[model samples]
Target: MLPVVLPLPLYAADASNTMVVSAAPAASGLSELDTPAAVSVVSGDDMRQAAPRVNLSENLSSVPGLQIENRQNYAQDLQLSVRGFGSRSTFGVRGIRIYVDGIPATMPDGQGQTSNVDIGSIDHIEVLRGPFSALYGNSSGGVINIDTQTGQQPTTLEAGTWFGSYGSWRNSLKVSGATGDGTHAGDVNYTVSTSRFTTHGYRDHSGAEKNLANAKLGVRLDDASTLTLLFNSVHVKADDPGGLTPDMWRADPHQVASNVSIYNARKTVDQTQAGLHYVRQMGENDDLSVMMYAGIRETTQYQSLPASSQSSAAHPGGVIDLTRHYQGIDTRWTHRDTLFSIPVSFTGGVDYETMMERRKGYLNFSNNGTSTDYGVMGDMRRNERNLMWNLDPYLQTSWQLTNKLSLDAGLRYSSVYFDSNDYYITTGNGDDSGSTSYHRWLPAAALKYAFDDSWNAYLSAGRGFETPTINELAYRSGGVSGLNINLKPATSDTIELGTKKRIGNGLISAAVFQTDTQNEIVTDTSSNGRSTYKNAGQTRRRGLELGLDQQFAYDWRLKAAWTLLDARYRTNACGTANCDGNRIPGIARSMAYAGLEYAPEQGWYGGAEIRYMSDIAANDANSVKAPAYSITSLNTGYKWLLSNWTLDMFGRVDNLFDRNYIGSVIVNESNSRYYEPAPGRNYSVGLTVTYAFQ
Candidate 1:
């Protein structure tokens, strides 16, 4: 295993705040909210204390109703599902929208897939659950908004390093401060960082490596206005061991094959994002913010297939390359005032985006003629272009019926349009072309009542819709009819009731929700061994979520959450009706998390956390189930403050018990008969130090 090197000169020790003005009580509290949805915020301080080793998905595993499945590789295997909405996908994120500083991170073609984010620069994350299409068009499941750190404090210098098991190591440094030296504080704040990560991977032929760089600059125009520029980039190189079949796992979970004939798969991805945000106060009672962003992302991936069931005489061993580009713009406005003694607020926004993508397949032949040899010729080429546009308008009002009672109501409407052009070609064969389009409407409403500062309750309902992604539509060949352009958009309706209560210094929250979806997309393998995508029948999911956060007078704190879900196919005309009543594939019926922490004024702190997930069915047939698993982690840190410098040290132990389990499962692409496991237990740790000048 190669030594893991943390990109140095990119780490910082000074902590930053993560509070956003949008979520302030005076801006839009629970009683004044406009949408029928659930939202939660994870502060930057909280994320720093947690110190996750990987990306956003790993850091958010504790969020209620969220499931993150890490496939251990950098590409095509990371799976993130919310409320069982994105489990059927093969690569990249789907069924949810991800935004950074209000810029759409997901592509325009309904494919919410991308890995351009730099978690180290993020200051806060806001998770909005249920159908929020009325707020963000064309998405039915949920929304993730990431806010990065800006110029909030004076100049400072920071750096850090991390070392742990599996030859892992990471180093970073950062500097940020005011540009002016005197009382005239009209200066800009800037931050730049870079990091490299590597791991020997648990299995043979699975080691991976990555490099990332990010920067941000913020200029304060006035007390009520600011402008900021952002940039981020990442490069990755990794080996693919290929997922193991269910039978292989049961026979020998630790066994890994290393073949001399297997060609090493390699991939490289580059992403650059640039955006400008302007915030201005329209008046004392209203405010408006506008942001424009443009991003370009490119990727090249090569894969060598062994003599698997996917290989054939007509289609021997081969390699494939994929590439893509995306661009978009977004804007929003907020207005608030009193009408007839009742508080009223209005919000509206519009977004436009375009995307272009292409794929090429190559074949190589060996003297032995084994299915594992890469043939010596190009087999196919595919190209696609997609365009999308959305508009949303919403209104919310609240009235205080009495000193202790309040009423809240809201409404929103969303419209979306999607169009795509696809083309395919085979060696010496002519090109085949096709085009398709889809449209949808979504709405949401909510009612909330607050008894006092310590207690609140609410009921909400909303509609959501999702169009088929480009990948599901463009990867078909001869015997395989590619691109289901005629497929209809999937639709969902959800209703939820919840309450939040605070007693003493402790907080408790609970919610129950039910969602019914139609036109769910399903991928099925035919007798010819090619996978086909189609819209399936209806499916229902209902669940309850409970969470508790408490702090003791002695500096001890406890946080915990539990979820119970009932998901099943309600109707299926595809002869798979028996899937009814079965637990949803890729979802655990029950999951729980608990954490204990101790932080005192003395500058020393530590914490321990445990997460548990119940067994999950690998497929709709319910013939196979991935066993339940639990993982424990511990972290500790100490800080020392002086007149000119601040020193700190921190470390953590993941998979404390070293339990073996599969992070995710999927049906084999070549054979309709089996499933594959992701990875097992692993560990990592790191530390940070800083210096400052006033």
Candidate 2:
């Protein structure tokens, strides 16, 4: 799709637009074009312009095949999925590998949360969405790598504030600097930032508040070694409005579900983490790198469950208090050499991670020998200490077989272990403790053929596996006791064919992929407000994605993306005799997005976007559905640069048409309170000022 037009200087390679896939690389490394995978990069400057810069969904709408929905209830986090892989998660992220800087954000059990991400200081985000992502180990349906901003020449201080509808406000401050000159061992750079955000929320009792801080320091040593240290902390308190039934949603979308106020349904989290990275050049053909990180997270949550359910000795109570300590280290060695007289590079590494948790549960009420207060702590129902760990050794290599052809391959051996100790035991609740372990050998391969400088084609295939998360195994169905130790892991084999084409001043890409899954984990039963899971026979998911980015004259740009997915159960699900061919729930079948922006060096700049998502099934049986909807938004801003100071003012309006829609859903809720409504109309405004000094 070549246009008869000359390329402008704006499309040329520059620091701002030079895209790279830092996550998928050999010892010598390779650029995005040379990686032979479906990868995309979104620059920070583009994300910061006329945006809230708060959530990942706000800036990632242009990336095809990624579905993100704002649940409005921050306590539950956002609902995100890549190629229908993680759509079933009720909280946090599943089936994806997330990393910030050089540290792992996903836990050893493959559960991840983005509440700690410092979006204000992000420099760029890289998304890898194909078979190649299997190299990252467990639950890697996709990989997301976020890189924070580095200090520039001349120290700079920035302060910003934003105000939005629903009584929402955000304030932030940042400082960064660099010292010394070129190649010197004493050279250093540092960046520090902090922010506070609060929201009244669109629905009743859904308010939330958060405080976050991040810091990074880098030092060069002896011109052959470098060290970087990173630290981050976050505290959050939020009210869970809970989900609404279809009748309740139709009556009043802004109302909280029943019994939420009585139980004070809420959640609180505090976390602090730090990491260190070291790199050194060995000889002329070898390099070594090492990374170590540790973190602590504390959480306390209250749920709305009836007292009758707690009367059963098997119940785990409605109040949960958990403290988790996690740490990990990774080391790698790379050798740049020739294989059979052909240019080749190889990298081998091992990663070890472990986590321990002190978990306790208590009833939500006390009898007090009189009337019961619904929110007071009554009796301890459960007390347990649990541990989980994983170890993996991986090797990757890339070879240039010919001038226009290349081959890349990798292998990894993964092992995961879990164990728990029960402390609270009585006649009714006997010793209900157990241990389990899982292991797998994962492999990936890809072949790339370059038709010319402007076009490239590739085919890749891989095998992936996902073990049962700790939370998923904590409880069993039918009000049974102890953990579901009989659960099995899910395995998948995927294949994809993709092509990338460079137009005059833009790029176009498309991919077709298919995956077959065995022993797919799914919800088995939801009784007494507790959920459990079991393995399904088999499942299938196939999808197509298309993306385009074009820049025209006069600083105007157009960005668009579209995705079509067909996911279904190929065999009996939920232990049914023959409920095969049912559509998988919680994921939209078709999605589309488009945006247009016009920005110049000076004067006013503005943009508008349109997004659409098709209807979705809400359960494994496909008995209920959520209607499809479309939304439109507009954003505008102005910038002024005078002397050593820069000033920017921006405003945005979401749901410009004020269309009523379901923003997200809780898949297969036992209580049938599945709908989470979107706000009708909303507005936000912000101002940023930066000063540069020596």
lDDT of 2 at 349: 85
Span of ten consecutive residues with least summed lDDT in model 2: 1-10
Q: Over the stretch 328-347, how does candidate 2's per-residue lDDT look in tens digits? A: 98887766677676767677
Give the residue spans of candidate 2 off by over 4 A.
Answer: 1-20, 23-31, 576-578
lDDT by residue for model 1 (557-579), tens: 88888888888878662454456
Work out how many backbone clashes candidate 2 has: 0
Measured on C-alpha atoms, candidate 2 has an lDDT of 0.82
Cα deviation at 578, candidate 1, in Å, is 3.6
Give Cα distance to truth, residue 631, candidate 2, Å. Answer: 0.5
Off by over 4 Å in 1: 1-36, 50-52, 179-185, 222-224, 254-261, 304-320, 364-380, 383-432, 475-482, 526-530, 573-577, 601-603, 667-682
Query: What are the C-alpha RMSDs, in order, of all predicted structures?
Result: 6.9, 5.1
